[model samples]
Target chain A: MLWTVMPLEAVLDGSDSYEPEYFDVPWNDGGRLIVEKLNMDSARVVRLISGNANDYLDASIQPGTIIQYAPKNQASKQ
Target chain B: MTLSPRQRRSSSARRVRTTPHPALQEQPKTHTQEKEKGQDVLQNIQQLGQTNIPQQLSENGIHTITIIGQIEGHITLPPQNKTTKYEHIIPQLVAIEQNPKIQGLLVILNTVGGDVEAGLAIAEMIDTLTKPSVTLVLGGGHSIGVPIAVSSDYSFITETATMTIHPIRLTGLVIGVPQTYEYLDKMQDRVIKFVTSHSRITKEKFRQVMFCTNQLARDIGTVMVGKDAVDDGLIDEVGGLGQAIAKLQSLIKARESKGGSTDALDSDAP
Candidate 1:
């Protein structure tokens, strides 16, 4: 049951046909980031699955952040 | 007069030659790093359509969390709608509870409310927090937002702010069974129990307001403006942000003093 001021139709519009594609990437301090794939190279962060309280404080990894998918070799070089 | 294509190209080439190539100029390492940072910021802006992420205020002991738009639940809302995801908020609350430097919390609400279970979860967390907290309701705090507004140690509503009290309803597909109705009623009771326990409003008064007729157009509910909410014992006061902060600070001070006395007693116990 939903308790909201918004109309039911407006809230559930497009939900039936839309299926989000999310990937779980290992993040800093053993945390995992749930990101929705936008394209091949990048994904938008949806949530951070972490037990560490400090992990939630990082601004760069907050929800809505676009994370670039760098290959292991390229990431290590940087 | 516009220059011919040949003349424009020749002029641009000459200008480029006169102004040494940017990369050829000797630059400090910091300058290059700053440029890269700027590019990253630009890319983030382009991708997220937002200029900057919200930074926690470090200058004060009080942390403010604004609950606006829809309170999202298990299903993510479409991108166009503004939503306060419970996942983001729950972690922040955990961080706030663990952080010793933070003395109080101020929740600012301007929400239409959303998923019932998510809203109740947030409210329960706020109510159980050991630190001093105050909620200031601006604009409108409707539906599930009422429970959240009352969850804090003290709640304030702006003079123009309003709260809509209405019965919870099921959305989407429903089986034509009596059990479904019973389940929905039980879910609603959880919200009513939380709100009535935390605030001064009685369960009877709240239910009366919730089932009130003739107050809302085409809806069975009552809309309580700031002062009316206070008068009805639904909210503590009708004030703005400043008052809410002042109240929180005072509450924090009281807690500190009480803690100090308890410490003194512990020392004397030995």
Candidate 2:
């Protein structure tokens, strides 16, 4: 995931900002995908394979979806 | 094994007419008092730990809509029940999120909790809703209600509210060996994972409470008093809606003031 520090003014339209959800496709182009964990600025873009976003949106994926990586807690360690 | 739950201690008929408490007890024959009385109950929940109730929102130049019901699953649970109706509430939450005048949501919960998938779905909607959401546990918000309790921007529970944090269960099932136990273990992990992720509890403490052997008569979990819940960091606050709303306002203002999101980044979609 890409981690970048951008101001809130960049990504948010004040009225049009959408919280991270399963509908959004990862726009990662291999190098390193930016994970804007706290960027309220502009919408941080993640590179995805072509048509990934559309397919992800059309697919009935549940919200609050996650990609668990490193062990942040004990249960995850296993 | 599609087994029914142990016969409910309550009567079957009593379960059928599960009407909203206010609507059942007092119907506002007078148009003036109807809205006023509803507002009063909302205020009481809001000011639970306090002495006085606030005046009507109309007088204060605010408009509000309070959705008070149990969100069980697909099945229409007994009225007064709190099953997360994913289909019904998912859209309602979406609507509420989009409503501009609806400044905040005061979600008062009195639920036994139901369907993990459904329960978490409701909690997720509440969590993601653009409008501020505040959840208060009145009598009990147990089982899956735990997640809904914490889903709010801020949370509160009555001094008497009780919460049961048991491991997940799929009511009657066919299993004879350790494999069944293994499946249960894995299912419980998912519940714990969600609970800990949404609340202040760490995975270790959440597991301890979920599997706390010393607490229940026939279960593998701990029941928490409102105060105990806050002390253990399972819930955010221990007062009723008053504290809950105050906390929610603070959170909303905090977010509104500085547009910072505390979203954790993950990839595998739920």
Candidate 3:
């Protein structure tokens, strides 16, 4: 349920057609970082899903920081 | 034969020249690298309007969490809408509670409020924290925001700030059944209970203001300005950032004096 001053129609406008492209990449020490894909190799960190409190303190993985991921084929080549 | 003084000095100078001067040799390399770094900084400034984004200070005992725009929950609103996701906030609250260095929390709210469950989750987290906390409402803290605004140890609203209290309602996919009404009523009761318990407002007074008809146009609720909220016992005081920080600091100090001394005395005793 929504409890807000904004009209329901205005708040949900374009919501039906809007689908975000988010990826879960393996992150530091077995934690996972959810990122919104910006391109083929790079994504912006959306949030970290982790049980460790220290994981949240890592500046590099903080939300809004951009990260680069290697494709499976590229990793195999290396 | 022994050389003259002048001849000895000339021989030493010639020996020094034979060995390369490292500083002179590295000057050109350092210059190019500095130029490249300067270009990167300039590019960063041009792109992000900031040369270096400031990171949160870990040493500071007080931490701030801002609830702005919408409190997004299960359904992700469109990208155009600015949202404060619960996934991000819940973990941060956990970190704040777990981290030893953090002694106080300051919540700054400027929200229209959204997602009844998400907002309550945040409020519940703040309310249960052992450390002292203070909340400051800058703009409109309406609807679900009311519960959050009062969840802190002390709540403040700027003289110009306002809070709207309204009953909760289902947005989409509402079935025409009595059960639907009951569900909404249950949700509304949860919010009322939270607000009434947290602040000085009573259930009867809160419901009266919530269902007040003449205050808002096209709505059945009251729009409480800063002083009005304090007068109604919804908020503690009318102040801004400075006062909020001062209040949080005092609360933290009070807690430490009360809790810290007993621990010290017990540990020191035989």
Candidate 4:
């Protein structure tokens, strides 16, 4: 249910626009997932909707479903 | 005998001409310009220093993909274990293929090998990428890592590096029956086919190394060190980072001259 919207630069070419906001989806167990392992089968999903940080994705994501996202690109800011 | 005043003056002038004042012997303007430019280049490189994850080398139109530690697959390894998760890499590869800025890929591998299917998945991705790629194996690229090392357009290994070619291994619950053996055999054949077709080594030679019983003290495989890998045609060359970078640059240059975007070649690819 947690979908990571990849930065445009990574998913596309020639566009320099920045995404202002990204919806954060909370885990069902309330346990934070490791960002590195977010791409494993347990963390992968075909598609997802980004919602507010406090919004629960339990209803949207079926049990045993996994979702993953690309980490926000912070290199440009530095 | 004391020389005359004229003679002394002339000799002193000759000495001055022969060895000019150290301060006046400043290096040529171009040399100083180059030195300053070198500093600028060094600064740019330093600014792009190694991050926790892979990044693009925009100037060279190349991106680096580091496959370190173990290739973790579906299972989540413990936090203490150093692993390169396949899911993380698959998306990155797709992005690299889509992004026009990325003209080539440089794969830096130093893995001990993990899940066989995961390793092969990453390897297959590299093999199919249209952008030219080069793999540099440092430390050890063992077991399933062998297929990955040879999957690139060109491969390199450091002087002290080693590679172990062994048959596929399975852990956890195994039925230990004839059907299990058949499944393992089919998977092993897939790996063998990929490695032999992509690399200079023949299927027979690779199988010889993979099934060798005498190489390891208590294992079934052959260990190739540096040039030994090149000799066996498993790796393209016995080289390190510099060589790997140079090869990638050359490939990028070649691709540009041929008027083919990295992906264009992929359409006509084998």
Between 1 and 4, whose TM-score is larger? 1
| Tens-digit lDDT track of model 1 for B96-207 | 7767667789999999989888999899899888888999999999999999999999999999999999999876688989999999889879988988998889999999
Ranking by lDDT: 1, 3, 4, 2
> What is candidate 3's lDDT per residue for A10-32, written digit by digit as tens?
88787665545455555556676
Model 3 stretches with alpha carbons more than 4 Å out: A40-42, A57-62, A65-78, B1-56, B260-270
Candidate order by decreasing DockQ: 1, 3, 4, 2
lDDT, candidate 1, equals 0.75
2 or 4: which has the higher lDDT? 4
Residue-wise lDDT of candidate 2 within A1-78, one digit each (tens)?
000011112312221323222113232232212221211211111211232222222101111111112112448559
In candidate 4, which residue ranges exceed 4 Å CA deviation?
A1-78, B1-56, B262-270
Which structure is stronger by lDDT: 1 or 3? 1
Give TM-scores for every candidate, taking all chains together and pairing residue i with residue i: 0.78, 0.54, 0.78, 0.63
Per-residue lDDT tens digits for candidate 3, residues B57-145, read 45557888778888987776665566777877888888878776677899999999899999999999999988889999998899989
| iRMS (Å) per candidate | 16.7, 24.6, 23.6, 30.3
Model 4: CAPRI class: incorrect
Residue B121 local lDDT, model 1? 87
lDDT of 3 at B15: 13
| Fraction of native A-B contacts kept, per candidate | 0.40, 0.00, 0.36, 0.00
Model 2's TM-score against the true structure: 0.54
Error of 3 at B52 (Å): 10
For model 4 chain A, give the 10-residue run with minimal summed lDDT.
A1-10
lDDT, candidate 4, B72-116, per-residue tens: 676544323345667657766776776766788888888877777
Clash pairs detected, candidate 1: none
